[model samples]
Target: MMFEPTIWIGAILMGLSLGLLGSGGSILTVPLLVYIAHEPEKAAIAESLLIVGIVALTGSITQFLKRLVDFRLVVVFGLPSMLAAYFGAYLSQYVGAQVQMLIFASVMVLASGFMLRPISALPNSNNTPNSINSRVDDFTVLQYLLLIIAGIAVGTLAGLIGVGGGFLIVPALLFIAKATMRKAIATSLFIIAMQSFAGFMKYTYLQSTQELSLNVPLIILVTVCAVFGVLLGGKVVNKLPQARLKQVFGGALIPLSAFILYNNV
Candidate 1:
């Protein structure tokens, strides 16, 4: 749609990956913008943020409509993340581009590790505590504090990397909130959308002095592909063995992060 074969090809691939895998599309977008579109690293980061925000937000709507989103957890996580995202954006403006890229790559590597980590066996599928006297059955104030801390840390990373923070957010929901995988994914999307908006605003303020141009055709093409991708992903996610999928996804990321970090540095 933008009449740039490479960019469109990249967008299509990104969309397809997002639909097929839940979280790898943003990782693909950065290299595509840099190598294929020949965009500068900084511009590519900004553009990727916009693209990821739009794509995730669109995917989020489906989860929301299905009543899968947990707003309580979203608020608990999203609030701190929003504040940290602004801080991350401010830091990005002053930091060198290569430093930012290196940081982004490091985060991806860590996130991949998290994705590959084994999930513990839950006592129950509902994730609701069965007894008041049970050690794991209580929600203490400290747990909430830990959640907020995790939110801020991951949000800072998201703002730095232009990702939606799902890589961190999903596991966090599972570990801290004790949410089911399905609920964690749905809640993470809502938080990502919120955090992305905050991060986008933060970056927008930093780049306010520059005249920006939107590649309108690019947006349409990406959005269309993203819509289809989300639907397709939703259809297939239930069929896959999540543990295997996560490991395969992590395997893909390690090398990519290394290459991007090396090239950018």
Candidate 2:
């Protein structure tokens, strides 16, 4: 395949969004693959899972090193998410591509709503924009169970739509786990990595059985560009006005989601 600058540029931007805004940025991946790279719909979704998973894993590693990640939460939330994500991928083959795009677009709209809401509207989080709050309380039995269920729900969406579900994941971690904003964000990255890989694996299987093959080299290129963006984003994450950034991102997503819906439906 010929080199595509659009895809690479989009990948970098996607990474920057994630690095700057957290997981919400990954919602851009499927659209980038489908519209810019011109991959088949199923292939784009699969490729998205792989690309997002790799980037999430890279971010998770850094968060882990900073002692920001909570492994206890990762195991509790990540496991169910991974399994549900696999099932979501497997289910996707039975659904039509147009329907999948519709679902993906709708999810983007929902994600934008999440972004548009005031941060205070969600669960109370002990956090400031700049500092990492790694402290977490022991979960109640009910909290653990709710987290497992939330994981399944988010993972299913992640697998089916090729989104990391970070917009949903961070909120769930905050509300259900009563985790701080920083910890929720950090833990959400780890969960996204695991579930995305699981979703990717199922899509890989579908590549053989359903004949929707992935562009491995393109995936690699996109991942590299995105990671570079993440690094760049990391350098400036604290400098930006996060609330305003989120508002801009949320507003931008509305029209983009509409365009996607228009094209698909």
The model with the greatest TM-score is 2
lDDT digits (tens) for residues 1-265 of candidate 1: 2567767766765655454444666666667666676666666666676777777777767778877677778778888997887777777877777887888788788868876776444322243544212232355788788889999997887677677677777777777777766667767766777776777777777775543344545556655665666666766766866667667877888988989878986
Every candidate's lDDT: 0.70, 0.84
Using lDDT as the measure, the top candidate is 2
lDDT for 77 (candidate 1): 84
Q: Write the per-residue lDDT of candidate 2 for residues 1-265, one digit (tens) a residue.
A: 3377788788998888777766687999999988888899989999999999988888777778877788878888889999999999999988999999999999999999988987776664447553333233456778878989999999999999899999888888777776767677778888999999999998888887888887888889999999988777767876977677777888889999999999997
What TM-score does structure 2 among the candidates reach? 0.93
lDDT of 1 at 19: 46
How many Å off is the CA of 170 in candidate 2? 0.6
